[model samples]
Target: MSASVERWLTLEGLSNVRDVGGLPLRGGGTTRGGVLLRSESLHFCTPGDVEHLVDVFGLKLVLDLRTRREIERDGPTAVARAGVETVALTFIPEDGRELPETDGVDPLVHIYLGYLRNRPDNVVAAVRRLAAVDAGPALVHCAAGKDRTGTLVALVLDAVGVERDAVVADYALSGEQIEAMFRRWTTASGEPMPADLTPHIPRAAAMAEVLATLDAEHGTDGAGGAAGWLLAHGLDEADLEHLRKRLTESS
Candidate 1:
């Protein structure tokens, strides 16, 4: 749908980097390209990849959603070393708080809901920072660019009125690249991905459910929508407006 969108970026070292743009909105228009990108960790980006991000793509900000332990384990990202402003906002608690056990929900879905329930403040802060990026494009990334990155990107796209299916499709795109991602991760870390976590790959239905839950908890319109969800958490209206303007292209 909507020409399928330009979803992937082929950098030398990264396998999961993508431009979150060109998706059709509800009424009309498409998401503006180059404003928002989502990716896996940039810890292994090559020098050319760093230049491509900074000089060609104008990457001005990087929102790293990795935990302190993960960052320390992976080391610094090339984007940060290249002098881009990088912000670390942990989406999951590092304090050992466990997700509520829910019967019958997919484990991945449960963990996603846990992010919203457990760390609304951090989620809100991430959106506010993305909204404030006026100098150049902003890249948001987590370990695999699947869970934490997916949730935040979904919220941002939904807040800007991108169709639910489009957002879900974008989330599911990561599933297509999982093998390549695993290879990159293993090569970089010299450790195999845990066997127990292998089954929780990105699924379209999972994101669809996430949006449905958000709509149920927050009103579909008015102060109950995605923008309202952020507002209730702590983001100001100006930042919300800035986000909508920055991401959406007119019909």
Candidate 2:
């Protein structure tokens, strides 16, 4: 493992955030930390957070998944240092929903799982970017660190040969991490936790369901898993190697 991975591994900021690294793949590989990351919107990171990501982590690429309106609302990430590349990708909207409907991060995940079913193009476009450029330590994100981020991360995981079940587990962990974060404090009125503020279990469950659907359509075969996704996105043998070289593959 590298020092950069240590800097961002399992990072739990006040807002929803995490490093989607260190998970075991189906065969015998694990995603290296700092090579890839997933998180909620960067609209609210403080200066300290940005400094940590830039100075300590050395992020070379950022895949922002928010809508144009969302970016206007949140403002751009303040990472102006050299050597960091920011790529904006707007996921194709299907099922008539713009993004996650409920504030619940998990339910919003449902939107993405379904979104990828008919619109593999969105996923492919992302892969195409990976093929065209070398964005090391890519961080993909949307609002609340779920939905668009999860869908893209799931595809990335699949592309990297991670088992479908393992991908779902990683997706579910986001809910647990965020839910636990919300439960830490309370209001003076002692009011029951607002549904909006609490973690969204339904959203997580829906995300799981979507993954199951993908399995039903496609199995554990590497062709339909990571390799298929690459081929679908028009990646050649060299492109696949380029991606594999970027993933963490050690103890």
Candidate 3:
């Protein structure tokens, strides 16, 4: 991995920022550094944070997966103010309440699955931008950067032929940061902390179930998984190929 690429970025106002790089690719090599990133909301990013992302990361695009309501409540983020092109593409609603309750299902898992079944168009659009050649050093973020961002990043990684276990491990990293994120939000907003953060923390099993479900439902000859879902929804073969080439390089 390049010294310039950090697995975790300790920005002034963000807790869950990370470069989605340095993971082992399926056949060989690793994902390219500084090409892709994921994070929690940029809503509270300090000016220094913005400069670091822009100057150091050479960030060009921000794919925000937060609902418009969330943005209305808590943005325009410092990063956006710094002039990086930011696009809002929501994956699901603010919470999982709109989804029908299922017996014996983890609500988070149900919500993650709903993102795929309920909102395929948004998913394709986000993936398209990530695959675009000019979308240099892009970051995808939602409020918590766990559910919506996690699901989308998982799809991108899986589509790019990142190992499945690596994909799940990447998703699970958010769990480690989520508590601190909530606390930071509380400190910033002056709101009382929630008594329990269980609902907000990600469960590795949820992601595992989601990917396994994708493979079972969308897989062609047991291989397609996320790539198949993207193709079925609207992304073309060329975009998938471009995504692989764009995000990965020889180690």
Candidate 4:
């Protein structure tokens, strides 16, 4: 297995949980483990999974990207019962399209780009929350942890100077667990996997294209890319710096 896939945490209830740590930064280091993790929704977290997150990971906060309606439909998550503070920052606005209809472009790519173009404010807020000094060892999640979560993770990884390829690789790691995720979801919700989950499976090319587009449209002088996009939106130098220090370790 690839080193990236090894980062997956073995949880009893969740299938797609992985630390964003150990990814190479552009400067010369790896992201620190136990600092930033990404996962699918925690609504199905088993008692053991909750204990593992709380005891083993020392999870201090949860950045829930699921919308309020999703939470209501799925019922409460075990993270709340574990006493972890979950800040719900809905990345896609409530009325936003779940699968953006596009003619010639990857739907995931279109929706990701839409997040950057349409809901930049929400994206910035997620970064600000993650950068908070007190949010120790936080985990971020949406429904599948592939689209909304992946886009947000890409932005955070990029802002911290993580190499673009490494960022994309991490995003694509979700694809490896897509089948398991669907099965887990089906068991929890008592519904079969959606008729067409293929489109939702993450693709490295899609994330790469999105990053390239960010550099094109949001980058300053054709350079900044994700960091530039964040600064352009609302995050300042301090926010980026905090994220870098909190999540990375110099080798």
Candidate 5:
């Protein structure tokens, strides 16, 4: 991994917390630092961790992609108590709720595609919220910061012309953190890992396939591309431009 891309923060109570910056853009420049971050749940963050995020990292917005039930069950996050604005934009509708059975696909892939098919508006809204953040950095996250978070981050990076491979690479990085995350969960909950959740491991090839599908659905580059697809769905042009400026460095 490139040094520029390995900017993980060592927080007292968080894991997989890293800045999504310094990624090489398609043309030449790298992503700007301290604007966008992706992480696992902040529900367990201590006061010091909150200080690091607010004072040191300048995190002003917490975009929680976990479902309503997850938030209620987990209670308040450190960010919320620290006065950082936290927005709940669940990527999966009726998440944790009982649903009709559907077969013929990898369950993980099915859930991933469900984010796009079931509630694309939420996805667009999440990006819009990130783009609208003006006070400081925005941290987006889900329960484990892998699937839902990865999908949204991929789209945001794609919208700004970050190389598709680089986006997939970033997504793949989440796989490196899964074992640690599982340990944390098991320790916290005092329960063995559930059989159903075991198969949801992150894979680079899965993300690669997603990007390929995205490119097939929308043009891979230029104005009428992935970003355009977001615009068509709900994201504003100005907001997209703001995100591009916030995340990308000048060449």
Candidate 6:
């Protein structure tokens, strides 16, 4: 994996932040930075963090893949740099999307499991939006920035030729930031997780299992995983090639 350990060490109060620039891909090169940025939901981000993103990183767009209910519960995040935009790139567009329907579930793990079930289709949609927007320094996030965000990141990285292990490594990076907050959110009583919280270890494991299955079914080097997902969305081989050229490095 090509992640910069030092750069990945930034914080904005909201946990689960990352850069996709340095991962090892199939070829000698790495996925380029300044193209795609990933992170947890900015719902609780501090102004300083927003400044770092805007002034330091020059972030131009914020893609939110969160379900509608999550937005209502937490409300919009306040990143006070004025000019950065927030787009409702939610994966589930069902006029009404409800919380996992579980009263006392661990909010982090449960919501992702729910996302896996109810809005699996949202996965490709979110990726398409990210590509089509062409917004530089774009940041994509879901509440806790693990499941929805991680899935989307996986798609983008796979398209860019990043290896499965590297992709998984980039994803698990969130655990250090995510778990700390989850522990804080869960009281001594261990109230059922907030539903928006991410059970870093287990959730990442589950996502890895899904991707591994995809690899087993569709050869890792061929039209499976990201390529397969795109095709399953009805995209043809030619479309895939064009997308690769447009969004990734040339082979």
Winning candidate number (lDDT):
3
lDDT of 6 by residue, 1-251 (tens): 43447537376475567777767777656666666678777865778887888888888878888767887787767752366777776765557757645576555445544554566556655555556535566788887676778777776677657877777777777676765667545653486666664335535565566566556655455634666755666555665554454455533
What's the ranking of the predictions by lDDT, best on top? 3, 4, 1, 5, 6, 2
State the local distance difference test value for candidate 1: 0.85
Q: Candidate 3: misplaced stretches above 4 Å?
A: 1-6, 93-97
Clashing pairs in 4: none
CA-only RMSD, every prediction: 2.3, 5.6, 2.5, 2.2, 2.6, 5.4
After TM-score superposition, what is the CA distance of residue 171 in candidate 3 from its true location, in Å? 0.1
Sequence-dependent TM-score of model 4: 0.92
Q: Better model by lDDT, 1 or 6?
A: 1
Rank candidates, TM-score, best first: 3, 1, 4, 5, 6, 2
Q: Give the Å shift of residue 150 in candidate 2.
A: 0.6
Q: Where in model 4 is the C-alpha error above 4 Å? A: 96-103, 189-197, 220-224
Q: TM-score of each candidate?
A: 0.92, 0.73, 0.93, 0.92, 0.90, 0.74
Question: What lDDT score is found at residue 116 in candidate 3?
Answer: 84
The lDDT of model 5 is: 0.82
Stretch of 10 with least lDDT, candidate 6:
242-251
Which residue pairs come into collision in candidate 5?
none
Per model, how many backbone clashes are there?
Answer: 1, 4, 0, 0, 0, 8
lDDT of 2 by residue, 1-251 (tens): 75233434443343456676777776787876766667776654567777667777777677777666777765667753344677777675523455535565555545665456546665666765654445655667776566677777776676676766667766666665465444532342365665784445425566566655555555454333546544645667776666665664854
Give the per-residue lDDT of model 3 (tens digit) for 145-184: 8889999999999888888888998998888887798889
lDDT tens digits, residue span 1-251, model 4:
97876798999889889999899988799998889889999987999999999999999989888888998888778888768998888876787556556879877688888877777888899999899888788999999898899999998898787888999989998988888888876876799888877776788999999999888877775344988889888898898889888988899
Which number leads on TM-score?
3
